[model samples]
Target chain A: MLGFVSGIDRDLLRQFERVSQQMERMMGLRGANGIRSGGVNAFPAVNLGASPEQVDVYVFVAGMDAEKLDISLQQNLLSISGERKAALPEDAQVYRNERFNGAFRRVVTLPEDIDPDQVNASYRDGVLHITVKRKEEAKPRQIQVN
Target chain B: MSENKHIEAQDQENSAMQARGEPESVMLPPVDIYEDANGFTLLADLPGVTRERLNIQVDGNDLTIEGEAAIDMPENMDALYADVASTRYQRRFTLSSELATDDIRAEMKDGVLTLRMPKRAELQPRKIEVSAG
Candidate 1:
């Protein structure tokens, strides 16, 4: 024991050091695709905009593979499901892990009526871009009066 | 006061024996530092921090990354299963003077934290035109 170490001070420092080290191993934050989670939607960073041509949806999901992606459309609701595989190596011993794994689902309400059949989704560089074509009936038709 | 100090010294000797080594590892989130035309982009791994829990403070050129990571372990489980009780991370980095601290922006996705520090207008490359008489 160092001369400066006191029982109370030693315990306090031990806890502080433990906490500080724990802070170092947080691999990443846990998040859901779109649904409300713990009072807050995982990202809540989706951009909401509707134009005449198509509806563009950008969902941020880094470190995820395309094979694990699942997108479904129910009426005006769009649900996305996938998983982010842990980045750790299989053979390595894990001292600590902070990233959430398993399953995730997010449901987004479409701003405009969309043709589910014509929707297209692509995942590239960690972002899931979904293009939902607007239904013909939902598009504005210019009407001329005499 | 002298008596208390003597007792405390003895107590410290015991504590020292209990805690004598460094933590296994001092790992941090994956960070990518890039310099672009606009400014610098810092991408860090911040697994358990939510937007509300994230705190960013830039005073002068000192950049601080402070955030709380809440663990998701259930309380009622008596049986043991594989687990990693790791949560919480904090780190700090110094910023360049050319960066616009006021215009810095951060966004988190999945477990990655992206920080964009835009360069000040004065630091931007501007083409100068010469008048021909």
Candidate 2:
């Protein structure tokens, strides 16, 4: 039943993908143990925004220390990686374990080239805020309208 | 590098607002609860929430955890892409009488809240020594 597609292939494929993803999220089965190998809607949802001066990326990751976080930028792709160690006491009996702990990665492709030196990252109240200034040449230049 | 990126571009043209009569959505933050010989340890993920904004209360065997995240967006900036949704965190747990609710210790750091609630003296495991015959 998964071999051939004859009519309305694109629509069917889109529907199927949406349904499957929703099911995975509902079942808490998404993400590769907190490692995102370049897939959309991966672990640790993020917000990306770009201003005239810089590009900003905010990732929601709690229970991680500075030593556990590793960030690097190569070309236009910015990578974020970190690990959240499990917080369980010794000889403890677990009642509920809904939160996920371990390694996680998130990558975003910027629209314009950013100066690697101008990148700034800060961790506050459990959120990691990253800002990369836009390159001077990449910013829009407006000529006097004649 | 052909990995899938989940970032979605935020639409800037359409400025829609929630209805005034509608109630704000409350998100149930994920948590882990573990019980040990002395007490229980609870860890909850509450990103973007400050210590002042987070509140934990226990009353009549009911434990409630709530936090509000204040994400201040700069006026000069515009959202180009977004995947994470902003939400207020809330969760409630019914505690057993065997647990001591008065001396619960709570701490928030790195966006995680850890709560240590000790069990009553009678609830904790204890070994009794037998007299030699």
Candidate 3:
């Protein structure tokens, strides 16, 4: 390994290291849709919003078939997995390639106060919307005046 | 020299406007342009854009596609883990003279927009027959 490392030019090795670091920073800093991913940068960009009674989760996954998408909930973690097919024809010559197409998995940790049984999800125009109702006990309660 | 200086000043003013957030941020949506026997096909990834808010226009040889995504946020909701943000989708494509720009067809489904630009009748291939004289 040391001999192999020395075989490459020092300047080339330095450039490679710099590029790798830059790639790591890019993947770590931004989420799928260029938003600030809190901790993990998964394939599908996700947004988690909550209301007083429920939590709403939105996943940005374009060109995905509805029947092929899979969503699972385990404890406080929600996993979304699916594949996006290439849109161009096989014989066509590609000019610009930027869209990503492959099997992807995104695991998001939801709030613990959510009710697992009451979770509902829907897909529209390529965005997956998931709504999980919060537990009654977790919601704010009004106190009675004696 | 005066005209060049005037152009430089205009460029500086435009950049200043961008820095001040006066101009909307434009994102380059990933796109794939393919050419085949027919003409050309363009596929763009535009997530969260609904049909009602999507628009496609063709002027001369320039084609423009724009869509607005209105992300539904619950009242008093906070983002615990956020990655994707709602934004407008805009892109432009320049067509060659060989293509029939007026007959271009566009369709949006599952957040992916597909545009088919057919070739002109004269540009299509035609087989010729030869006879011995």
Q: What TM-score results for chain B in every one of the models?
A: 0.68, 0.74, 0.76
**Model 3, B1-133: lDDT tens per residue?**
9999999999999989999977765555678898988888898878888888888998998888998876777779987666654378788888899999888988999998889999998998777888879
Q: What is each predicted model's overall lDDT from 0 to 1?
A: 0.63, 0.79, 0.82
lDDT of 3 at A110: 82
Clashing pairs in 2: A38-B4
Q: In candidate 1, which residue pairs get closer than 3 Å at backbone N, Cα or C atoms, i.e. clash?
A: A28-B46, A28-B47, A28-B48, A29-B46, A29-B47, A29-B48, A34-A106
TM-score, each model?
0.40, 0.74, 0.77
The digit string of per-residue lDDT tens for model 3 on A8-27 reads 87778899878877886797
What's the TM for model 2? 0.74
In angstroms, the error of model 2 at B117 is 1.2
Model 1 lDDT tens row, A4-101: 56877989999987776565334223422333321222431233345665676666555566778899998888888876654544453343444445
Fnat of candidate 3 is 0.93
Total backbone clashes of candidate 3, pairs 3 or more residues apart or in separate chains: 0
The second chain of candidate 3 has a TM-score of: 0.76
User: What proportion of true contacts does candidate 2 retain?
Assistant: 0.95
Q: Give the top-scoring candidate (DockQ).
A: 3
